[model samples]
Target: MTSLLLVEDDAVIRTSVSLALERYGYHVTTADDGLSGLEAAQTGGHDLLLLDVMLPSLDGISLCRKIRETSQVPILMMSARGDGLDVVAGLEGGADDYVVKPVDLPVLVARIRSLLRRTTIAQPQPETGQVGATLAFGELSVDTGSLEVRRAGQRLELSPTELRLLLEFAAHPGIVLERATLLRTVWDYGWDGDSRVVDLCVQRLRKKVGAERIETVRGFGYRLNTT
Candidate 1:
């Protein structure tokens, strides 16, 4: 059974969400505050983490950052507000995804499944005419077989989502990839998915790979600059 750690301060929400997730075949563990949540996360050996944004002691964003410093375990943040800033902060703080509160169980489960599915790094094939296990884009190199990424001879510490996003762009090199396409391909989101995830992930990827390597195509999408 897949185990999950849920850190939520609200007693009502904590109970309800844990019960629902258990019904969905997950082994669910709960924590009511951020500090305990962080502690449980460090020792729990959970497959994933469900974190509520507001919590006593540490807050979810800080906890997420602390966890990210050592582990790449998938994190999904829940916020009572759907404000863009909150979502951005959660993502920037190392969450793989975020869900607005008044939580919809079905949607939350879907997001959880998607995050878990991505934990296994897919071996991305290089584009036609490119013949090697390692795909090189100027200073950046992605070794598809070993699932390692390096920038200018230095290994980059990237989350699974970030590495997958980089691989998608590296495989297509120079070709524009629409946000919607990325939503489906990279995140496994259906047609009405939020583009913010794509944009934010791109921003994070650029910071590691260098901003100049990825070109924004105005109203189109994004392309990995091979020149």
Candidate 2:
């Protein structure tokens, strides 16, 4: 049986979710606060985590960051409503997906299955050991295998999405990669998220890797300057 941690302060919601998940063959562990949930995740037993955005202690975003710092255990965040800010916060905090409340039990189960499927396929990434075989572009260096980027030997912290964006731009340096194409290629959104998501990630990446390293063409997409 797959083990899952369900962290929600609402007793009714918690019990219902637990029973539903149990019926679906998941052994669910319940927690009423963010701290307990974080402890459960840190213990290294659960296959997945179901986190509530609000709780009595600590917010879901902070807990998510703590969880991601060590474990890549798939996290699915639940919110009171489909608030975009909450969803984005969850995502930025390393949650794999978000679901709003008043969700169908069957749909929730399906989402859990989908998230687990992705988690099952995910391989552990190698540690950032060596920044070798570096692809040098002007003052920027991207080390693919180590997944590190540096400018003038100063390390830059790139989120997973930002890193993927940097790689795509690096691969096709000096090319006018369109917003649609980049959304499809970098995010695998296949134009679903379109420019907004891609553009946000790109903007963050630019801040990390340095603005000069990435050039924004008016009414067009981005490119590595290759200066």
Candidate achieving the largest TM-score: 1
TM-score of each: 0.92, 0.62
Q: Give the TM-score of candidate 2.
A: 0.62
Stretches > 4 Å off in candidate 1 = 122-132
Off by over 4 Å in 2: 1-6, 10-30, 44-50, 65-76, 80-82, 91-133, 155-157, 194-196, 217-220
Candidate 1 TM-score, C-alpha based: 0.92
Model 2 over residues 36-136: C-alpha lDDT tens digits? 98888888888889999988788888998898777767788897764778777777677765678965787678668766755533333666665446798
lDDT of each: 0.89, 0.76
lDDT per residue as tens, model 1, 94-190: 8888899989999999999988888765434456666558888898888877678899999998887888888889889999999999999889897
RMSD of model 1, in Å? 3.4
- RMSD (CA, Å), candidate 2 to true, equals 5.3
